[model samples]
Structures are given as structure tokens and as C-alpha cells.
Target: MAAAAAPKSNAPHIPVLLRPLIAAVAPVQGVWLDGTLGAGGYARALLDAGADQVIGVDRDPLAHDMAQGWGAEYGDRLRLVLGNFAQMDDYATDLDGVVLDLGVSSMQLDLAERGFSFMKDGPLDMRMSQEGPSAADLVNTAEESDLADILYLYGEERASRRIARAIVKARTEAPIETTLHLAGLIERCLPRSKPGQAHAATRSFQAIRIAVNDEYGALIAGLEAAERALKEGGQLAVVTFHSIEDRIVKRFLTARSGGGGTGSRHAPEITREEPQFTLKSRKAIGPDDEELAVNPRARSARLRVATRTDAPAGQSERSALGVPMLKGAK
Candidate 1:
């Protein structure tokens, strides 16, 4: 389940914050891994930026197929693997760097047949690996409370209970099987979006997609995997799209890099482990106006880059990172 890529591809998918990411991790070289590999934008950039080799890892089979069109030019320089980035440590130890772009790719979202977007009409299948219980199954079978928790916790949607109730009632009438079908039901429970706002079903769809794909779990595991895989001085750069995701990445880096302040007398300053990483910057980097003009998706994207150290790698508290978990610990 490992992959590498060539210097180029017909990847129309724009790599958001490409300039900023490259700038933040300047002098990119050695062996790098593109964990997301959605259209191979980051892989190509890293290869072009003088990485001796680039390993492109992605769980989606379609990504591998897409890479085939242009991956051969780099030959051994570009290796493409088929697997979740959560196991990135197993792909290659001592990697010079790891790049992860979280959430659904533009390619996946644009294609209605993939079902990642409620804006489009397609099957209720949002599994990134194209395997496992689909969104349709989750909607049709998961308990009402679970659905409510998913929307409220994972998505931060306030109307989760009402929408969950509606979903349970609607499915009883008939199985919720399509993107539009489910979106339509949720829309009825919410107010219409204004001219400048997002669609009514945006948050609900995001929550379900996150649940169906285990995105947050994969994200935390992937960060840990990056820590375990990177060599001393190697970098880990992540680009997140939402507040929750940004918060998780920010907290993970802060904790691992020893950014947490000393505790008071009542708490007693506990001895801390050797720092695993050093933050490139205290604040996340974002796209400039030029990049934003070219890619509006870059608006919400935040880049957080840090370099791994020789310290032993360990897990960060999940609650500290704000990873939303289901009630039954399912």
C-alpha cells in the first residue's frame, strides 16, 4: 500500500496553498511522501522541488490509476502505493517529509457518482477507499442518537437533533439512498441559505461524510504515523480546510512541539517528554490574495508545517486534539 509519482500529471486538481506550503518548507529535498495524493499535485511539486524521490500514498484506487498516466517518467523516483496514510509509518521509515491534504479531494467532490458532495446528485457512497459501510448505509441503519452525535460533534451543526429526527422519520417511509434525497430531507428542517452563505445541507453532509470515512480518526493516526516515519529534521506539512480540522492540527503540533506552558503549583508542573517536533511558525499559513484568486477553495485552507526531531514519538490526547468520537465508542 505504498505509491510514488512522476514529475507531472494531467491533474486538473489544484493543490491549494501550494506556494505557501512550498515557501513554509523551503529547500524541499530528499525522500518525501504525499499521503493524500489526490491528483498528485503535491507529489509533482515535491519531485520538482528537488526531492530525490517522492512516494505517493493514497487509499483510493482511482488515484493510483490517475498516477499511471504520468508516474512512469520519474521511474523509481516516484512510487505510488495504495493504502491509508494512517499506516504511513509502515510505508517508509525515515522519510524526509510527509504531506497530507485532509478531507475529500476536488476530483472526488466534483464527480457526483462519488457522493462526497450534496451539491451534486449521486449515490450516498462517501467512502474514500471505496470500501466499507457507505453513507447510505449509515443513514439507513445507524441509530438516531448516533446520527445526532455525528452531526453535532463532527460537523458542529446546531440543528443535529431536528435533522436526525427527520432522517429517522424519512427513512422509515423509504430508505434514504441518494445524495439529493437525504439533502432534501435535511433542507426541510433548516432555513434556506442566503446569497453569500453555504447550502443548507452543507454541515450535515460533511458530518456524515466524516463518519462514513473515519476522517478525523485517520487524521490523528496519520499525524502520529508521520511522527513515527520521519527522520530527524524531516518535516510534516498538513493543510486543513475547516475550523475543527485546523484546531486539531494546531493542538497536535503545539503539544508535540512543547508549546504548552508550565502548569501552576496546584497542578504541579509535570516532567515532559523530549520534544518530537519544532513548529515552523506559531501561526498557520494561509494563501495570499493571488492564490486565493486562482483557487477560492484556498480561502479556508491553513498550512501548518513542523520538523520532526530525535525525540521518541508518542500519541497526543484525543480530547486535547478535539477529535469527535461517537458515544458508544463505536
Candidate 2:
């Protein structure tokens, strides 16, 4: 349930913020893990930048298949593993560094069969691992209120109630089996998009996909896993493509780095645990004008890096990180 990459198969595969990422964690050596190895862009760059070995971990089988062709040139320097980044601690411990690109790859999005995009008409199956109760199943089976919560909480869609109601009404006629069918249904419930605006169904589509993949849940687990897996002085670099993703990463780093201040003026200053990570920068890094000209997709991307400390890793507060959980979910 990594971040789903925007569909851009026709476009060149340039790893977002690759240049700045390398510069941020310069002198990259020792074993590194690329947690969301979408298209293997980060893994290849890490290897080229002198990492002794890059362990590429991804839940999607497509990523591994694609890596087989390009990763071969790197020989043993590149190690591919099939699993979620949430279990990264199980994959390797005492890592020199970890790089996570949360976005789904263009290969998955561009292919209509994979069903990651609303633009293309495909089965409503947005499962990143290719195994799950797919988007179609959720839409056809979930309660209207549950659907509304997913759209509002996960995608920040304002008209979630209306859309969910419409979905329930329509599903009775027939199952919402394809991407365009759902997209069109969502479009009918919302105002039309103006020039330079996103599609009317964008938020709803994103919400359904996120729910199907459990993206936010995976993201939180993955960050903690990175903390447990990394060695002291090990760097963790994350490239987030959306505001929610960035906010979660920012808060996680802030709390771990001991920058989270007291809740209120009257609140007691409690003793804090030893900081687990040190922020490389107080602010997130974004694509520059030069990079934007080459890849506009990088425009929304933000990079955050932090170095591990010797402190023992601990669970992060989900509310503190703004992770949206559906009601009735623990």
C-alpha cells in the first residue's frame, strides 16, 4: 500500500528528486534499502552512487519483473525482494540507509489492466500487491456510510456523502465493475471541472484506491519499520507526492527528532525519551525549476531526510501524524 504513482507511461522515468536526494545523503555507502522500489529508479541511483548493495523491496510483482531486465546489469549489487515496506525490519536490519518513493509506478497506472487510473477504462482493481478485495468489491459491498468515510477521510473529498449515496443506488442496478463506470458516477455527483482543474472524479478515485490498498496504514508502519531497521547514523529519505503524505512524514520526523512541543501552555513538560532521529533539515525539499521543466510530476513531490540515532525505536502516535482512520477501525 505504498503511494500510488501518477500515470505517465509515455513520459520518461526520471526518479523524482533523484539529484537532491543523493546530495542530501551524500557519500552514500554501505547496504541501502529502497522500500517502494517502483520501477527501481531509486535502487539504480543508489547503486550508481556507490552503495555497496541496494536491497529493493516492493509488494508489486510488476516491479520485480521489470527489475529483472534492468537490475541484471548491476549483478549482485541489486537485491530484489517481494514484500511490503511496512515489514522492512524483517527484510534487513542495521541498514546504512533507506529510500522510499511512495508513489505507484507508471507501469501500473499506464496499463489499463492494472486499474490504477480513472482516465483509463479497466477493472476496478487497485490492489498494489495484485491480491486483495479490490476496489470493485469494496464499492459493491461496503455500506454507504463506510464508503463516505473513505472518500472524505482518505481522499479529503467534500461531497463524499452524496457520492456514496449515488454509488449505493447505482450498484443495485449493476456492480460498479470498471474504473470509468465509477468515475462517471462520481462525476455526476460533483460540479464539472474548469480549465486547468483536475477531473471531477479525482478525489473519489483516489479515495477508493487508497482504501483498496491501505496506503496510509502501510505508510505509517513503513516509517516505523525504517526506524527499527536502520543503524545509528543511517539516513532515511522519503519522497512524498501529496500533502497528506508529506504531513505524515513531517510529523513523524518531528516527533522522533524531539521537535514536537508541548500541547498547551498549561501542560506539564514531561520527560521525553531519547530522540531516535535527527532531522537533516527543518523544511521539506521540492523540485527546482530545472527538474520541473523535465518532469512536471515532480512539482508536487517533497523530500524529507533524517538520520537515525542510537535510541530504541518506538511506535508513533497515529493521531499525531494525521493518519485518517475509518470509524470502527482500530
Candidate 3:
């Protein structure tokens, strides 16, 4: 395999926390899998860092298309798979390492046609795989209460009911068809944003996108898949963008590392068994000043790393992971 090349000025997007992530999992080698191979930043880095082979998996066809150009440089050493990371175990097992960078890819957000950005005006579609129900479908058809649940639970939007009511009202006049249309509607429903604060529509858009993609559900499933796929001593490094994601990763690691105890003071004590993984650190790695200077988008990114144990992989209770669920969702 070829050595990893220096980052190009025209690179699709900067890989957040790349330096810290590499350092945390130093001496990167053997066969590894990159679960969220968006722009192939991590994949390229791993390959360059001495991984003999890297399987890049993503559900978005855009990722696969983009991979064709740069991936050719690595030839057979870099393999691309068009599927969600939740099914990573089926792709390969006994892996040396697995890297999952959660959240929408920068490539997807930069493309207006992909409808991930509020800054860009385009369709209301937020499908990572570019299939299934889109943001537009949910915005126009979902019941007001359900939309409210998504906004409050997924995006942590405080004015969820207000926004949901507005959406229901606006869609009745005509379908909420485009990105800007929905963004504008949401902005109208909220108070004006203060300088340096996120846009008024930010939380609502994030919630809608999460609902449209089943991101949280897939995240838990992917973590479990990583647990099952890695061999003893295999490493798992996950980078999460928001608090909710970071919390889930932290809890999953805690539970698997044998720190998880009873649900509450009133709850029954749970039995323990051989743990499946060992935590590399109880703390998550965040971007340093240099990284923040280079890429402000990485400000919220958090990386957690753990090593697989010889114990057999087991399923985790989703409820314990702090996965926000809509009412009645299983």
C-alpha cells in the first residue's frame, strides 16, 4: 500500500480531531475498518499510519463515488463498502481496529442538493443513503405531536411544540418542500438568535435530520457491531460531534468496561460478568488549540477509544445508553 499523502488544500473536509485520534490509537497497524468513511480522511490516515488494509464503509453512494478517485491510489489496500456501519460485523470480523466518525459528513452538508445545511437552500431531503423517507416527507406528513417529540428529544429544541405547530400550519397551506422553506418557518417560530449563538433553526433542523435518518438507533447498533467485529486486543476509536452522541458512547464504554451498575438507587443490583472491552481512558479527547484554529467545525467533536477484551461480545440495553426515543418507539 502507498503511504498516506499530505492533506490537499482542496480536500473535501478536514477530518476532525485526526491528530489526537491517531495519537490515542498510536502504532496503527493491521487490518482496520472505517465505519464512516465520508471523505476518507481517517481511512487514508490509517492506511498511511501502517494499516495493511482498510475497509471503508458508508451508506451514502456519494462517499463511494468520491472514493473511486482517491481510493485508486491505495489500490486493493483500501476497500469501499456501500452500507451502514451498523452492519459492520457482516462486512468483516477479527479486525485490528474500527473507526466510526458519527454525524452527517461534511461532503453531504456542503452539497446544497443533499439538503443537510441550513446555510444552503435546496431540497428538504436529509437521507444519508439518499433513500427512504426524507426530511420533506416527515415535515409535510407527520403529526404535530410526533414532530414535537422529534424536535424535543432528538434536537433538544426547547420550543419544540411551537415549531411543530408552525410546521403543521405551514404545511397545511402547502407542503414544506425545500430546505430554506422549512428553515425560514422554523426561524419564524423561535426568538431571534444572539450573536455567536447557533441559528434559531439549528436545533429543529438537527432534530428533523436525526428523525429522517434514524441516526441514534444506527449509532447504538454500530457500536454493538464494532464490539462483535473486533478481535481480542482490537481497538475501537469513535468520534462524536454532539453531547447526545458523546453520552451514548461514554455510557456504552462504561457498561462494557464493567462500570455500569444498577439503574437507580431504588433499582435492583445487577450481576456482572467478564467485560468485553477495556477503556483506554475515562475521559474523551477533544481538539486542541491548533486543531480548533485549523478547523472551527471540530470544536464540539469528542473522541473515545477502547480496546477489545477476550470476553465474548454481548448486546447492550439501548435504554441504558441514553438514546433519546420518541414516545412509543421500541
Cα TM-score per model: 0.95, 0.95, 0.95
lDDT of 3 at 209: 92
Best by lDDT: 3
lDDT of 3 by residue, 1-330 (tens): 111222233778789999888888889999999999988999999999999999999988888877888899999999889899999999999999999999987778878888898989998988988888999999999989999999999999999999999999998899988889999998988889999999988898888898898999899999999999999999999999999999999999999998878758887775668899999999999999998998999999999999999999987977899999788899
**Better candidate number, 2 or 3, judged by lDDT:** 3
Worst 10 residues of 2 by lDDT: 3-12
- Model 1 clash number: 8
**Candidate 3: segments with Cα more than 4 A from true spot:** 1-9, 263-270
Write down the lDDT of every candidate, Cα atoms only: 0.88, 0.90, 0.90
Q: Which ten residues in a row have the lowest lDDT in candidate 3?
A: 1-10
Task: Arrange candidates, best lDDT first.
Answer: 3, 2, 1
> In model 1, what lDDT does residue 105 have?
79
Residue 297's lDDT within candidate 2 is: 76
Judged by lDDT relative to the true structure, which candidate is superior, 1 or 3? Answer: 3
The candidate, 1 or 2, that scores higher on lDDT is 2
Q: For residues 204-272, what per-residue lDDT tens digits would candidate 1 score against the true structure?
A: 999998898888888989999999999999999999999989999999999999976545668776788
Can you tell me which runs of candidate 2 are displaced by over 4 Å? 1-12, 263-265
